[model samples]
Target: MKTADCDILILPGLAGSEEDHWQARWASRLPTARIVVQDDWHAPEPEAWRRRIAEAVAAARRPVILIAHSLGVVAAVEAAPDFPPDVVRGALLVALPDVEEAPDLPDSVRAFAPLPRDPLPFPSLLVASRTDPHCAYARAEDFAYAWGAQIVDAGDSGHINVASGHGPWPEGLMRLAGFLKTL
Candidate 1:
């Protein structure tokens, strides 16, 4: 479906997306896109994050398409089962951090350990970087296989965030546009 025909929910990771973050920029550019605000971004609570995502999907006037990064990707996968299959059309999951193996993981994020492995009910794509500090490429491939998502190799990009110099990532926008077309 065209972007105007759906609700694009941008789900940022811990600490939320800043003005320079790509997710924020994309949300601003897409008329139907909005950020899914969490109650606490610095101290993430898995259940709370999941509930917020569910609420956002529930409130969408049209089919929902999720654009998630880092920890937000984990929450989306965990909350997928709770969402009505017809409500969510697709998702673009980027930089999925391996919290289970991440050293010095914050207590808040550690609570979401052992990430869910169930296949999502809707179409999904997982984009991972070969040089991401948070997760290994192999692990990302494992996640794609388990979740039944198509995997996209994003070269050596680091975490694919603003800190990684992706504030106005046009290539990512193209990828998102492609994903949206399939829905």
Candidate 2:
């Protein structure tokens, strides 16, 4: 499906994406895209994050296409089963953080631990970075496999965020466009 035909929901990671983050840039460019505002970003509660995603999807006027990064990816996956069937057409999941195993993350992330292994209900693509501090590349592959999502190796791309120097992320936009075409 074309972008214009879907509601693109941009779900940012912990503390939310900065103004220069790719998600934020894309939200400005993509006519139908909007960020799903979380009630709290500093210390995430898994159930609240999951419920928020479900609520966003439930309210979409058109078929939903999720653009999620880091913790948002986990929340989206956690909320998958709650979504009304077929309401979500697809998802572009990037930089999935290892909430279960990452030692450096805050303790609160543990609430989202033991990541769900069920296949997502919609078509999806997971873009993973080999050097992301939050998750191991192999683990990202595992997530993609479990979710039945096509995996793209973004070699050495640290979390694919602004700090990693992906402010505009034109390449990501191209990849998203390609994914949309397949739907």
Candidate 3:
């Protein structure tokens, strides 16, 4: 199924994607896209995040396509088991933050130490940056392997957020569209 044929659910990272963030820009550009709201974008409760994502997937009318960034990527994995595989066609997982090693990491994130590594039941892509301060390239690849997702290199993009200057993120949107076409 084409990406345009599915319900695009964008999940932002810790602190949430700002108004001008790539995720926000994509939502405006895509006629049928919406953001999956976490209970608290700041506090970051794993179970709450998981439940919110699961609920969003459960309510989806069409095949669901997930676009997640930063800690939201982890939450997506946590919610994966509850998402009936038939409804969730694929995901664009990106910018995993190292909650384990972030010295100044919030208490909420550290609480999620020892992330899950089980392979995902659906087709997905894991996009990572070489210079992301939060996570190493090697670790991102490891996640891709464990989650059974195809890895995509995003060069030196910093967490792929607005802070890194990915305002419009036209390229990322095009790439997402390409992935959606394959679904």
Candidate 4:
């Protein structure tokens, strides 16, 4: 489906997407897009994050398309089963952090461990970086298989965030546009 026909919800990771973050930039560029505002960005609670995403989807005027990154990806997966199938048409999941194997993960993030393996109810694409510090390449592949998502290898793009020098991330925008076309 075309972007104008859907509500694009941007779900940012831990601490939220900053002004320079690609997710934020994408939200600005896409007139139909809006960020799913979480109550707490610094120390996320899984249930709360899930609730926020659900609320955003519920509030949308049209079918929703999720643009999620890092922890946001986890929250989306956890919340998907609860959402009405027709509410969410597709999702662009990026930089999924492997909290289960992340030794240095904060207590807040650790709560989302043992990542949801249930296949999503809608079409989705998972974009992963080979050198992402938060998740190993093999683990990301495992997630893609388990979640029933198409995987795109983003070579050496650390977490695919601002710190990784992906503020504009035109490549990601292109990929997102392509994914939207499939829906």
Per lDDT, the best of the predicted structures is: 2
Q: Return the TM-score for each candidate structure.
A: 0.98, 0.98, 0.95, 0.98
Winner by TM-score between candidate 3 and candidate 2 = 2
- Per-residue lDDT for 1-183 in model 2, tens only? 899999999999899988999999999999999999999999898999999999999999999999999999999999999999899999999999999888788888777988999999999999999999999999999989999999999998998999999999999999999999998
Give the candidate order by descending lDDT.
2, 1, 4, 3
Model 3 agreement with the true structure over 35-118: per-residue lDDT tens digits:
988767888888888888999999999989999988888888878999976988999998888777756678888777777789
Root-mean-square deviation of every model:
0.8, 0.7, 1.3, 0.8
Per-candidate local distance difference test:
0.92, 0.94, 0.86, 0.92
For candidate 4, what is the TM-score? 0.98
**Cα error, candidate 1, residue 52 (Å):** 0.6
Identify the runs in model 4 with alpha carbons over 4 angstroms from their true place.
none
What TM-score does prediction 2 earn? 0.98
Per-residue lDDT of candidate 4, residues 132-165 (tens digit): 9889989999999998999999998998998899
- Deviating ranges (above 4 Å) for candidate 1: none
- Runs in model 2 lying further than 4 Å from the true structure: none
| Evaluation by lDDT, superior candidate among 3 and 4 | 4
